[model samples]
Target chain A: MTDWLDHLLILPILLPLAVAAVLIPINERDRTLKGAIGFASTLVVFILSMILMRLAAAGTGSLPGSGVYQLGNWPAPFGIVLVLDRLSALMLCLTSGLALAAQAYSMARWHTAGHHFHSLFQLLVAGLNGAFLTGDLFNLFVFFEMMLAASYGLLLHGSGPLRVKAGLHYIAVNLAASALFLIGVSLIYGAAGTLNMADLATKLAALEPRSRTLVEMGSAILGVAFLVKAGMWPLSFWLPTAYAAATPPVAGVFAVLTKVGIYVIIRLHLLVFGTAAGASSGFGQEWLVTGGMLTIAFGGIGVLASQAMGRLAGYSVLVSSGTLLAAVGLGHDGMLAGALFYLVSSTLTIGAFFLLIELVERGRDAGADVLAVTMEAYGDFDEDEEEEEVGAAIPGTMAVLGLCFCLCALLLAGLPPLSGFIAKFALISGLFDMPAAELATAMSAADWTYVTLLILSGLAAMIAMNRIGIRTFWASIEGTIPRVVVIEITPVVVLLGACIFLSLQAGPAMRYMQATADDLLAPLTHSERVLSAPRAGSQ
Target chain B: MELILSAGIGTLTASGVYLLLRPRTYQVIIGLSLLSFAVNLFIFGMGRLRVNAPPILDPGGVGDLARYTDPVPQALVLTAIVIGFAMTALFLVVLLASRGFTGTDHVDGREQRGD
Candidate 1:
C-alpha cells in the first residue's frame, strides 16, 4: 500500500501524457470518444491524487524522508528527480480536482470546439503535475514551457478574433518571461556550478559574498519571470485580457496558471534563498513582503476598475497572488501556512468565478445599447458605452450569476465563516507575531505601510465587491433571457461545493498547511531526509 | 575571461530588454533569443573557467575532487537549451499564426483591432 503511494506521484503526470498520445490518432471529429477519454482520464487522475493525499496524511514512510523518484534510477544531482512532499501532494490534489471539474464542464460546452481540446487539456495537466513534482531547475523550465504550449492551444481552443488578439499578447509576454527564465537559470548555474535545487542550496551558501550577491540578483530576475506568469502587478497587464478572452473551461483551469508561478517562488525562496545568514541579505525576506504588498494594492485597484465579469475574476486572481506573496515575504511558518490555505481557497473561488462568467455571458449578450437603455431607466447613464455594454449579463443567467457572485464576493472579501476569512486571519495573525529581533530592525515606516496596505486592500476588495455585485447581480433588467444550460451550472456548483467543504475542513487543512510550511521554513529536515535514502540500483 | 563573459551578459540583457520593448513581435522574438543565449553562457560560466578540463572522470584517477569542473551545471544547461528551443519554436509558431489570423505583427493587437 505504501509503495503504491510512491507510484501514485507519477500517475497524475503520466496519465495525462498517455491519454494525450492515445487521443492523437483518433479523428478530431470523434467528439464523443475524445470527451469520454478526456473526462475519464482526468477523473482517474483526480482519484489517484486523492489517494496520494490520503497516504501522505497517513504519514506512511514508504521511501523514508520526502519521496524523490529519480527517473531511470539516476542518482540525485546527476539525473532528473520527481520529489513528492506534503506541499506537492496538496498542489497535485488541487490541480487534479480543478482539472477534473473543468473537463466535466468542457464536455457539454465544447461539443463543437474540435478534438484539440482533449489533447491540450491533458497536456496542460501533465505540464502542471510535472512542474509541481520536478526537483531540478532545468526540469522546471521544461515543464513551464510544456504547460505554456498547452495553454496556447487551450487559450485559442475556440478560435475567434478576441481570443486570437488576447492570446498573441499572452504568448508574447510569456515567451519573454521564458527567455528570461532561461537566462536566469543559466546565470545561476554558471555561478553556482549546480542545477539540482538541493545541491544549489548547499553550494550557494559556500560561494564568495560577491558571487552570492550575483546569484541573489539573478534569482530576483528569475523571480520576476515567475511573477509575470503569476500575474503580479506591473507585469500582470496581460493576464486579465488573455483570461477574459479564453473559453470558460480553459479560463477556469488557467486560473491555476499563476499559482504555479507562486509555487515556484515559494519553493525556491524557502529552499535556496532562505539560507542567507542575515535578514537584510540581498535575497532576504523583506523584498518579497514589499513586492507582495504592492501586488495586493494593484490587484485590488484592478478589481475595482474591471467592468466585465471575466476581467473582474482575472483581477481577483491577481489579488490572491498578492496575498500569497505577502505571506511568503513574512517568512514565518505560520504565515506560509496561511498563504497556502488561502491559495487553495482562492484557486477554488476564482475557478468557480470563471465558470460563472461563462454562464453570465451565455445568459444575455450584454450589448452597449441594451446597457444604455437600462442605465437610462436608472437615470445614471454617465458611464462609457463600452463599460455599460460589458456589465450587461444575460437575463436567465442572473440567478446562477448572482449565486456565483455571492460566493466569489464572500471568498474575495474575506467574510467570516468562509475559507477566505479564515486563511486571511491566520496570515494576519502570523504577521502580528513577528519576533522583536525581526521587528526591531525594520523601519517603522515600512511596517506601517505593510499593515495599512493590507487593510486598505482588504477594504477596497469589499467595496469593489459591493459595487460590482450590486450592479451585476442584484440589478433588474428587462430583456429576452436565455435559459441557463446544465453544462454551465454544473462545474460552478461542484467548485462552490468544494469551497464550502474546504471552509468546513479548515481545521485539518490549516494543520496540513502548517506542516507543509514548517517543512519549507526548515528545509534542512527535508534535505537530510531525502538525501539520506539510498539511490535506486545502489547496493 | 570572467570580465569579458560578464560584459557579454550585460550587453545581452540590455539588448534583450530594448528589443522586448519594441512594437514589433519579430524583434521581441529576436530579443528573447539573444537573452537566452546570454543566460546559457552565464550558467555555463558559473562552473568556473577551465581551459581544457572536462567533467568526465579519468578511469585510473586518484580520489582527488578538485581536478574536474562541476558537471551539474552542464547537465542543467543542456536540458535548458533543448527546452528553450522547444519554447522558442512554439512562440515562433504562435507569432506566425497571429500574423496570419490578424494580418499584423504588432506586440499588442489593439491597434490592429482598432483598424
Candidate 2:
C-alpha cells in the first residue's frame, strides 16, 4: 500500500509548517527573503494541492472513499491519520488559492505592518490544511487551536486601538470554543472508547441508546464550538468588529477560516449521524435548519444596517456563512452542491473585497470623508477638493477601484452574469428540487422561507453596497485616485478573475461539488478506507 | 470515582463560567485557565481514570484494548495541554497590550457607567 503518491497527502500540511519554521528565525530586517520564501512556499502548496485535486478527480491513493495517510504507519483507530477525500482536497485548494492571493497583496505593504506577518500567515495555512486533512476528532481540535492561535497573532499583527479591542473579544470567544471542543472530544471518547472519526462514526451507529444520548449531548456542545467559528448568529456578535479591525490581507485569509468551521460541520454531522446513527439519526437536524435560517435573516439585517464598507464586508461574511450552513442543514445532495459552489464564490469575493477596501480607502480620509462629501453639497469643499486633486496620481485608479467594487457588490449580492448569481440560482433551484417526493403537495413553508430570505438578503446587500458605492465613489467631490501598485492590484484581479472563471465553468464546478456532497452524505466507504489503510512508515 | 471527578469538573466549570462573565480582563483570563484545567482533567478522566495501564504499544505491534488504557485520548490531552498553554500565554500578552493601550483592564477596554 505504500507508494510514492502516499506522501503527497501530507505535503500540504508539512510544507507550510517547514517554511514557517525556517522563516521565524531570519532577521525581521530580511523581509525580502521572507517574502520570497513565503511566496514560493504558498505557490508550491497551490501547485501540490492542484495535483492532489487532480488525483482526487482521477481517483488515486486510497480514495473512491478517501486517501488515508497514517502519520507514523500505526493504522486506523490507533494513530493520527490524514485523509485526502474530495471535500478535503477541494478545501485545500481553496485555502492555497486564498493564501497565495493574500500573500501577494500583503507583499506590497501589509506584511510590513506587523513583526512576523509571513510566518504567522504560513502557520495559519499549515493549520488550515491540517484541520481539513486530519481524520481524528481530537486532531481536529488541535488543528482548530493551531489555526485560532495563528489568527489571534494575525488579528493583532498591526496593533491599533480598534484591533486590540476586537482581538480581545475574538480571543476570548475562541478560547471558550476551544475549551468546549476539549470537553466534547473527551465526552465522546469516554462514551465510545475511540478518537478516530471513522471509528467513532462506526461506533456511534451501534451505541446503546443511553450512551448515544450522551454522545449526542457531547456533539451538540461540539457543534456550538464549530457554529461559533462559522459565525452562527447569537454566538457571532464578535465577528463584524473583529473582521473590520484586522489588516486587509489578514482579513482576506480569515475569509476561509469561517468556511473551515462550515467544512467541519458538514463533514462531521452527516458522516457521524446521517442515516447510520440509530436513535440519534439526524440528531441536530432541526436545530441546524432553524438556527441557520435565523442566522441568514439576521445577517441580512446586519448588511442593511452597516454604514461603513468594512463593516458591510464583515456582515457579508455572515450572510455567506448562514447561506452555506442552511443549505447544509437541508441535507440534500443538490442543495449542498449548490451551497458548495456559493461558498467558493462568496469567500473569493469577500477576500478580494477586504483587500480592495484598504487600497480604495488609502487616499481618502477616514470614513468621515463621505460625510465630508455630504457637507460639500452645503458648500464647504473647495479646499478638500484641491487637496484631493493634488494627492491624485493615477488616472485609471479611480476607474479600476470603481469597477472592482462594482464586481464585488455584484458577487456579494448574488447578482447575475457572475458566479454569485449562478450559485444562488442553483441553490434556489435545489431548494425546490431537494424534496422531489414532496413536490406532489404544496411547497413547504420552510422552502418558501429559504427562497424569500435568499432574495431578500441579496436585495439587502445590493442596496447597502450601492449606497456605499455611490457615497464612496460618485458623491465624492474630490477624485483622489488610489495610488495602487501592481502587486496589490494583481491579487484582487486574480481573485475576482477566479469568480469569473467559476461562473463560466459552473457546470463542471457544480458537478464536482455534487460529487463532494455525495461523498460526504454516504461516507461509509470513506470510514472503511481510513480503517483499512496501512500504517504510515511501513513498507 | 466518576462522581468525584464530575463534581470537581462541575466546580471548576461553574467558577470558570462565573469568572468568564465578569467584566475584567484578568478575571476572564483566569476563568479561561480554570476552564482549560477542567477540560484537561475531563479529558484525562475519559481514559476511565485508570491507575496502571500500559501506554501506547511499541510501534508495529498490535494494540490490545483490554490490557492498555487508551493512549489516543492521552496523546490528545497532551497535545491539548500544550495548545492550551500557548493560548493562555497569547491571551495574557494580548490582555497586557490591551490594558496598556486602552488605559483600562475592562474586557471591552472601556469602563461601564455603573461599574
Candidate 3:
C-alpha cells in the first residue's frame, strides 16, 4: 500500500468525528452551514470507501495495507487494530452511501426540526464506521455504545409525543441489550485471556473443554444482544413502532443499524467459532437458522397487517435482516454472496422508501389510512364515491413519486427485472446447488423451509405494498400534491437509481460479493493476516 | 471472595431484571442503571478478583502474568461505567419528556384500562 493510502483506513471514522466536533459549536440557527459541512464530509467518506473497496479487491493479500491496521503503531493482539477487507469496506461504502442520502434528505426540512441534528448524524456515522472497522471485541463494545447513543439522539430528533413514546421503548430495550453485551465481552475475555478478535480466534482452538464451553456461553449471550438489535423474532417488538415513529431521514439511516447487528454476528461467529475451533465449531448455528426463519414469518405477518406505510417499511427491514441471518447460518459460500447482494439492495431500497413515505404521506389526511382500511373492510361504505375515470391527471412530482414507489415495491417483493429478484434467485440456486461430489443428495428440509418462507415473505410484501400504493395514489386522487423541494426528492432518486445501477451491473456486483464471501468463509486466513501484521513503526 | 462477588452480581442482576420488566418509565430507567451496576461488577470480577496485586508493570522490567492483576477488565469496566452513566442520564431525560408529553409514566405512554 502507498504511504498516503495506509492512513486512509482510519479516515472514515475520523472525518465524521472531526466534522461533528466542528458542527457542535455552530448555532442551531446555522442549519445550512451545518448541513453543508456534514454533506461534504460524508461525500468525502463515500469516495474514500469506494477507493478502499477497489484497493481491497485488488490487494488479495499480496498488497501492503490491504488488511490489518494497528492504531498508534501498536502491534496486533495487544493494541487497537482495524481490519479493512472486502466485507468491511463494503459495509463502510453502504453506510456512507446511506448517510449521504439521509443527510441530503434531512437538509430539506428534518434537520431544522431539532438542535444539533447535523452533529448527531455525523456522530452516528462515525460510530457506525468505528463499529464496522474495529477489530477488538471490547473496542467493538465501545463503538456499539457510541452508535447506540447517537441513534438514541437521532431517534428522538424532531421529537413529538409519538417519537418520545417510541424512543422510550427503544432506549430501554437497547440499554438492557448493552448490559448483556458487557457480560458477554467480559466472559469471553476471562475465558480467552485476550480482547482482540484475531487473538481470540487463535486462542479458542487451544482452549480446554471447560473454557471452550464458557466461551460458547459468552458468545451465545453475545448473540442474543445482537439479535435484539437485528430485530429477530420475539425480540423485535420495539422495532416497528420505534422505526415508524422516527423522522424519515433518521429512519432511512436507521435501516442500516439493524444490519450492524447482523454484521457483528457474522463476523464474530465465523471468526471465533469457525472450523478451527475444536469442540466449538458452528456453535449456535441452529438457533440462528430457526430464529431467522421465525423472524421472517413474523415480519411477513407484520407487513400484511400494517395499515400504515411507515410500519410497513419497518417490517420490511426485519424481513431483510432475517434473510441475511438465515443465509449466514447456512454457511454456504454461494448463499452468503447472494445474502450480501440482498443486504445492499434491500438497504438502499428501504432507505429510499422511508424517505419517500414522508413525501407520500405529506398531502394525505392523518386519518386517511384508518379510513381507507375501514372502507376496504366494509365494502366501500362511503356514500360520496367518485365514479369518474380511475386515472387522474398526475403532476410531475407525483409521477416521479409513483414511479419510485413502484420500484421500491418491486425491490422489496423481489420481483423480476430488479436486483431483488436476482438476489433471491442467487440465494435459492446456491441453496440447492451442492458440489459435484454430493450431487446424489437432494435438498434438505431446512433448505426447503427457508425457500418457502422467503417466497411467502416476498408475497406478503407485495400484497401490502400494492394495497398501500393503490390507496395513496389511485384511490386518493383528491389529495393535494405535496410541495416537495428538489433537494428532498433527489436523494430518493439517487438511491433508487443506485438500485437500478446494481441490477444493470449484476455480473460484477455478484463477483464482488462472491469474493467477499470467499474471504469471510476462510477465517484462518483472516486471523493470520490480522495477527501477523507488523506494527506501524516496527520492521 | 469469588463466592461473595458472584453472589452479589447475581442478586443485583436479578433485581435489575425484575425492575426492568416494570411498566413505569422511571422504574425502567432505574432498572437500566441497576443492570449496568451489576454488569460493571461482573466485569470487574472477570479479572479473577485479585487483591493486593499491581495493575501496572513493575519498574524492574519484570512482566509476569501471576503478579499482575489483569488491567484490561478494569479498563473495560471503566468504559462501560462511563457509557452507562451517560445512557442513564439520557434515559432519564427521555423519561421526563415522555411523562411531560403523554402525562403518564407507563412504558406504553398510557395506563392500561384496568389500571
- Point to the candidate with the largest lDDT: 3
Per-candidate TM equals 0.88, 0.94, 0.98
- The C-alpha interface RMSD of every prediction is 2.3, 0.8, 0.5
Q: Write the per-residue lDDT of candidate 3 for residues A172-236, one digit (tens) a residue.
A: 99999999998999999999899898889889989998888889989988899999999999899
Give Cα-based local distance difference scores for all models: 0.78, 0.87, 0.90
Ranking by TM-score: 3, 2, 1
Evaluating just chain A, the predictions reach TM-scores of 0.90, 0.94, 0.97
Chain B, candidate 2: TM-score: 0.88
Q: Write the per-residue lDDT of candidate 1 for residues A213-323, one digit (tens) a residue.
A: 777777877898898998777788899889989988899999899999999999988888765424323364676777777888888888767666677788888888987
Superposed model 3: Cα runs more than 4 Å off: A62-64, A382-384, A388-392, A435-442
Each candidate's fnat, in order? Answer: 0.74, 0.96, 1.00
The residue ranges of model 2 lying beyond 4 angstroms of the native Cα positions read: A60-66, A369-394, A434-442, A535-539, B51-68
Give the per-residue Cα lDDT of candidate 1 at B15.
96
Model 3 interface RMSD over true interface Cα atoms: 0.5
A399-456 per-residue lDDT for model 2 (tens digits): 8888999999999999899999999999988877735676757466776787888899
Instruction: Looking at model 3 chain A, report the run of 10 residues with the lowest lDDT sum.
Output: A58-67
Question: How does residue A179 of candidate 2 score in lDDT?
Answer: 92
